[model samples]
Target: MTSTFLGMPTTAPRGVGHLRGDQSFPAAARRALADSQLRRNLGHATATIRAKSAAVIAEAPDWQQLRDAGAAIKADVMARLPELLEQLEAAVTAAGGTVHWAADAVEANRIVTELVAATGSDRVIKVKSMATQEIGLNEALEAAGITPVETDLAELIVQLGDDRPSHILVPAIHRNRAEIREIFLREMPGVDPALTDDPVALAAAARRYLRQTFLHTPVAVSGANFAVAETGTLVVVESEGNGRMCLTLPETLITVMGVEKVVPTWRDLEVFLQLLPRASTGERMNPYTSMWTGVSPGDGPQQVHLVLLDNGRSAVLADEVGRQALHCIRCSACLNVCPVYERTGGHAYGSVYPGPIGAVLSPQLTGVEENASLPYASSLCGACYDACPVKINIPELLVHLRAAHVTAQRRPTTESIAMAAAAYTMDHPALYAAAQRAARLTRLAGRRGRGLPPPLSGWTIGRDLPQPPPQTFREWWAER
Candidate 1:
């Protein structure tokens, strides 16, 4: 159980998960912005997704109504999360599946590792799961002497290259086909030596490599898109059929999902299925939508285990304004439309989650002090709010988190001190007029196109300040 006082989470200490970054957002973004190739990759990919999403979303006559319904459903679920979770546990248990509760990432990782060990397997095949990634499960498994193989093509590319995922839907979005070809040749053990940068050739090579592992791996791990409380059903929506294969082929399966993923009824699930695919892949519906309850007589994995993860979610739910971030369906729509994200790329945000949602969510989950710069990463453009199928109002959330960060600071910053001086000057007419007259002296400095000095230089580096007018409006009026 996590508690919040004065808008701060007191539950878990930081540094356990992937939410905090090694460097502040500005420092990381500077490096990413300098990489012209990375910008080209992101620009081309995001543009395509945005165009496709707009076309498909336009086809739905009831899109706004659906968004309303989805928002309402999420609001209800958040309000009654504890009760719904208990109901979900009971239903899953009744259907012969085991349920486990994990307070944080460490506990969840230990539970999944022990389950894999009990199966007596040294290797496991995996479905692409953000929840598992959030917990750094693959790294944890390797530390325990077990190997985890990623089955998704994008995830496989990331794994082979030993690179971090830059986009939520497309982990390797930062890499183009040529880079992927190079990675396959260098790292994929059985890859064809003649593999080309052609998409078809690259995909076939990966499929051939993963075929045997899919057939023989005794254990599989996944993350659910939604869990139905009424029927104890778990759902996974994916563009590729790999998730379906992992769900069925393995003898034992373990699923780790965020506690916020549970919806009270099947009716609520209906809204998201229609919303997720269109917003994410720009498809009318996912190519593969896998749903299962507990276990079937011999149909799927015999042993099913569901680990409901908290990992600061309870703390997020404690804050009224910040909790809406949990409504994210992992759709990259916000990313596609975010100017800051499209330009700087996801690696700059320094979290498993990125974009406008990440700017707000990561700070709240890890506490504002740990991820302080994230809140200021956005330009407050409202495109993300418009693109969100669940209507998260991401721009508003960014502002809210920024205020939280400023409030959390123990000392007054230079910006705060400057603001205070400006406020004081504005309150008195004589001081304000004197300050205006003193400002005209800057034109002398501006003759050579010089920028403000020291504290104000950072703002002027990317922009040009106009020369002050020869006379103020007040001065002109007085002369008349």
Candidate 2:
């Protein structure tokens, strides 16, 4: 497949407290354990990427500078988005392409559906796009009586399997060869009853299934990684030729993109194109990168429509501290490198995006006051920051969210009591030393008795609390 994701057309609330904030992320994580193949597949796939990415990144001397540049560029764009988007709309209109602005997922889907309906076609081929998935565009089109055929291989797998994407980049990361083989056997027609688990064979099976969709479907839907404002151009990079095929073959093309995707100039595309492929897929250059500015006179998609969707992005832009989360290029490098995300996988986070990015991005876009647990889902290992091509400070955002969570609720009983005692102990060193000395003497007492008193139960309950040295470190330092 050309794309890493075959995301389920997400079907939850478009509001702040959708499926995510209303329920804790753990219930979903627990349900995911029922699939043993998913566990095995995720473990094998992520481990390989983690090792390979680390090796390649370690060898690069200018990687940190590249990350800094990417971050700075994104920050500049976010700060200037209102102006850039205006410039983009003007350029697109002048170039004879119509632009549509959508306030949220509902509006975006409606705009796309209406545009397709105008074409008088009930079926369209699609390039795998997370924006469309986030807005549930396929289902909206389906409800409107339009059948959207997925052209990307992984997306085809997910569509046929009726599964939720488990990874941001590799949506079907949780499923292995045998499972894919099973999916193809059940959904795909004219499959040799003797399909092997080999990677090449699996890819060939998908290629054969999607060949007709590419040739026949007239209208196409896509999402962009970056949209150059200066020229009103849209760009998509991928490993396979499927995206290229979808872009050129269709009579009418509709591209839905986030407002944050705009850059000031075409020169900026070069920088991201350099950083994204390597950070995302460990590749020096992608096999196919398709770029189009509105439409040409006689070539490829005589009618082009661009949907600019802002589903909570404007609210996210309002927060200074959390706004950096938008700088992510959707490179799965962070998820691959994050120890916690590696163990839990993407589905555990219960959002279109999952992992460190999801932990902060979902909450900020959806509002963190309600999604209190998602921020705490991380171990704060800082691996995501280290791996981020755009240098988002994920750990710092986590700490900020943690503080916000604490302030939202009236402090828990045990936490309040424990912290108060800690405050009292730290305020008076002499008294603290005396208390410690008394507690240390308990080991000898415990030799004769069971354990310490109720106040000490919290510390001593889990394992043996070590006896203090003859004197405290402070006293020893003073003597020295």
Candidate 3:
């Protein structure tokens, strides 16, 4: 990551490299894989969303066309981002929208926290938003003595329980009904201790608890799904009405959005409106769709502040192999389908972002050094690529970032030396032939393969190695 963007530390101390080789995952995966509760929760949640998403796609005959249009439009915008952004600024300003550009996470956090404080309210209601999470907005607000009350059902569950969101679409996805019941019993003041694990009971508990926070909080914070620059409008698509309450009820509204969320025209929204819901929550249309522009004449939040955050976006935009990352609409479809994420969930990634998008996007935004392990976290199965509506090519990017990391490193470790030796052997026929012959000689002629003994135990840690083939490809080639 750049040292400072618009004058602030662009990356964390551990950095993106931490994610690349962060052996931290295996420990978490081992524990979570055995957690039958986590497995059941993920299986049920992803399956339901998958079926609902399929139904929506089936209903739209032009679904593929819309996806194609969305992809093409995003590519076009990325190509001419500077010019389009200038035009966007002009259009939004002309339409009475106030746009504040933030160069890094700290600046963005400062801007939003100050805006909330200006409302002169100590508490602010919040919609479930990734951008806010990306910048750690809630923590920043709290540090400034402004309490952010999460109003979305899942967000409320996470906040009340003092937990981090493990899934993008369902922030409380890791918690089953029983866990939620326990959290409510412990955290919610008026919650009845007799509450059961029924969905109805859980929702009622959350509603009653949030209603009080909603009716009183004078400020709200949110993240946008998309912004239409042509009309200077911001759109939020959500399944719950809590997002609407947080958006409309507050006197002053502060929205923290990534710079890449902007689309050039109003008509382009039609494509995303279809793509986001089905891909994200697996719905044809979210229950609450809210839109707002600059200051609405006494209708919504009287004073609106939109912070266009460019934290690490400009750097990602500069990279040729990694730029497609910003095309993500925060759908989390990639996460839902990711096998690695399925086991470890979001926390293992160690940032606001998790799963496939987190693997690549986090490193690019946070810098490759600190999160380097993130790129290696993938099996490069290409499942994320198949699931992406915008075609992010996540697996391919993972490899590219991995190569960059190794090449930039000063020391060559055992794995690096082995890779180099293999590359050299493959390139030189004589050396490969001699090595093959030696391996064949070492192999037992007519017995089950024995495990490699200690000192060489590294090769046998997981399984016994199969005997080498009797004849090398060179020997076969000679016979032919």
Q: If scored against the real structure, what TM-score would every candidate get?
A: 0.95, 0.86, 0.89
lDDT for each residue of candidate 3 in 257-331, tens digit (9 for 90 to 100): 888888998899888988888788777887889988776777878777788887788878888878899899989
Displacement of the residue 437 alpha carbon in candidate 3, Å: 5.4
Descending-lDDT candidate ranking: 1, 2, 3
Name the 10 consecutive residues with the lowest summed lDDT in model 1: 4-13
The worst-scoring run of ten residues by lDDT in candidate 2 lies at 8-17
Query: What's the lDDT of the predicted structure labeled candidate 2?
Result: 0.80
lDDT of 2 at 178: 86
- Best candidate according to lDDT: 1
Which candidate number has the best TM-score?
Answer: 1
Residue-level lDDT of model 2, residues 1-480, one tens digit each, is 546343222223444222253356665655655667666777788888877766666677887877778888999999998999999998887787889998778888888999899889899888888788777788889999999987777787888899877677778887788888999889888887898989899999888877887888888998999998999988988877888888898899999998888998989887798788788877767789999898888989889888998877876787788788878888888888877666677777877778898898887766676566688778798988888899899999988877777777775755567788879998998878877767667777554335556765644543365655777676788799
List clashing residue pairs in candidate 1. Answer: none
Q: Per-residue lDDT tens digits of candidate 1, residues 1-480?
A: 545454444443455668878999988999999999999999999999999999999999999999999988898889999899999999999998999998789999999999999999999999998888888999889999999999999999999999999888999999999999999999999888988999999989988999999999999999999999999999999877889889999999999999999999987888999999999999999899999999998899999999999888888899898899988889989999999999999999998888988898888777778888998898887999999999998888888888887888889987788889999999998999888888898787555568888787766654587788889777998999
Task: For residue 384, give model 2's deviation from the true position in Å.
Answer: 0.7
Query: What do the candidate models score in CA lDDT, each in turn?
Result: 0.90, 0.80, 0.79
- Give the least accurate 10-residue stretch of model 3, judged by summed lDDT: 12-21
